[model samples]
Target: MKVAALDIDGTLYPGALGLQLLQALTANGISDKSKSEDVFKVVEKYHFNEIDFQTMATSAYTLFAEAIAGISQAVMQCIARQVWQQERTKLFPFVPKLIDILNSQGYSLVLISGSPDEIVCCLAEEFGISKYQGSIFATHQGKYTGKVNLLSGSLGKKYSIFLQMIKDWRVNLEESLAIGDSITDTALLQ
Candidate 1:
């Protein structure tokens, strides 16, 4: 099947999904705030362009990796829905139309994101897309384990991950479409 690969952050919405998840976790008191003050400072620097996206992403990833430890997957899923609802209005006007068009054409919509998996699920559900991959926080028996596996790093690594996610990658280069907005997406786009 043809795959319509997409990124959720800047490509689908004008904001970063990972950042929003972190903020929501902190706001709802689901996250441990011992390091939030410093974390937000890194985020602020990213907003002001004082630091790069990688730096900000790494900082947030590290913080949330620790904060979400022991949080139940079910609770995280609920918060993911809440975060999506809160930010749903911020989605681009063309996104739905584009998704619908892709769906009608039978292209399998596959989202590959650096955002947390819970939020990615909401995004996939928004467009009726079933296939997606995202940054993972290891969990056991429905609770987070504080171990992280982020996909926001080097393109080479991202490319390898994409290969692992796609069962058939060689045949889709011609008919498949890729939508992305950052260097982190080079893997799926290629």
Candidate 2:
């Protein structure tokens, strides 16, 4: 049950593309531009208060989820993939070395992200991470299907999938480590 979880946005990468995207949306004069700023404001408010990582992460997730709700899955995937490829320039310097070390030590590595699966998968591969885990809320066939599948977020991220991984691999949590840079990951770390 040696598990290690890594957060994608600020934890893995240096800059916040999510916030940048929000700014872009506002600059472009997209409808309801203020909503984007409001989300960032919420995030900033939490950060200013020195909120715990889990709470901050949850708030960030909520912001993203709300903003992405009405968008089509295809568009969401495109946006996520594009942002990851174009906007992100640097990752934590220790990420690659740490993953290798953890793998050698027989610790299972899990990349849990609130970002879309398409984006997270790309990052995992780029970082040479062998396995991937995370959630993307999306629809199919260019329709806004109300139901969203959990690619790897919230409870599914912290417990369900992690537990299943342990059960399938016959490992124990005592030997596991979860690493993340957000408040949302507090649950997984605990």
Candidate 3:
């Protein structure tokens, strides 16, 4: 099968889903607002092109993971839905058109993001894309265990996931296309 590997942050949408989820958690008092300020600062730097994608992504992921270390699965899911509702309307005009074009061309769309699985699932559902991957947090007793899977499917882990996807899905590399806004997308693009 031919594939269209897609990135969500800055590719499909204007902002980061992880950040939106983090903000929602903090707003709901699940995480401390003071702790989130640093993550936001890094994001601001990223927005101004002051830092490369890798650095910004790493910093944001670290901060977000630390903040949501103990949240329950149910709570995270509820907040993820709320985030999706708010972010759905802010997608780039090109995204829908691009998806349609790719679909018509027989490219199987696959979303790979650095955001949490909950939010990634929401995005996949919104776009009707079945095959996707995102950060997988470790949990114990239905709560976050302060640990993330080594293969979280974004940033440093993206290439491995992309390779696995290619193998599993039997993707035709010559006929496939990849779109992303950062160095994180290098593996898929390459």
The number of the candidate with the highest TM-score is 3
Q: Per-candidate RMSD vs. true structure?
A: 2.3, 4.0, 2.2
Per-residue lDDT tens digits of candidate 1, residues 1-190?
A: 6778888889888987767877788888887777555667777887899988777777767776777888898998898899899898899999999998998997877888877888988988877877777889888999988778664443445566556667655546578888888888776676
Candidate with the greatest lDDT versus the true structure: 3
Candidate 2 segments exceeding 4 Å error: 15-32, 50-63, 128-131, 138-140, 143-157
Residue 178 shift from truth in candidate 3, angstroms = 0.3
What residue pairs clash in candidate 3, if any at all? none
- Give a tens-digit lDDT track for model 3, residues 1-190: 9988899988898978877998899999997576677889888898899998778777776776667778898999999999999998899988888988999999998888987889989989988999888888788899887666643534556767877766767777898888988767876677
Sort the predicted structures by TM-score, highest score first.
Answer: 3, 1, 2
Task: Provide TM-scores for the models.
Answer: 0.86, 0.69, 0.89
In candidate 2, how many Å is residue 189 off? Answer: 2.5
Query: Candidate 2: worst 10 consecutive residues by lDDT?
Result: 23-32
Q: Could you tell me how far off, in angstroms, the CA of residue 119 lies in candidate 3 after the best superposition?
A: 0.8
111 Cα displacement, candidate 1 (Å) = 0.2
Model 1 misplaced regions, further than 4 Å:
47-53, 152-154, 168-170
Q: List model 2 lDDT by residue over 85-125, tens digit each.
A: 76656677887788788888877676766655657777777
Locate the minimum summed-lDDT window of 10 residues in model 1: 151-160
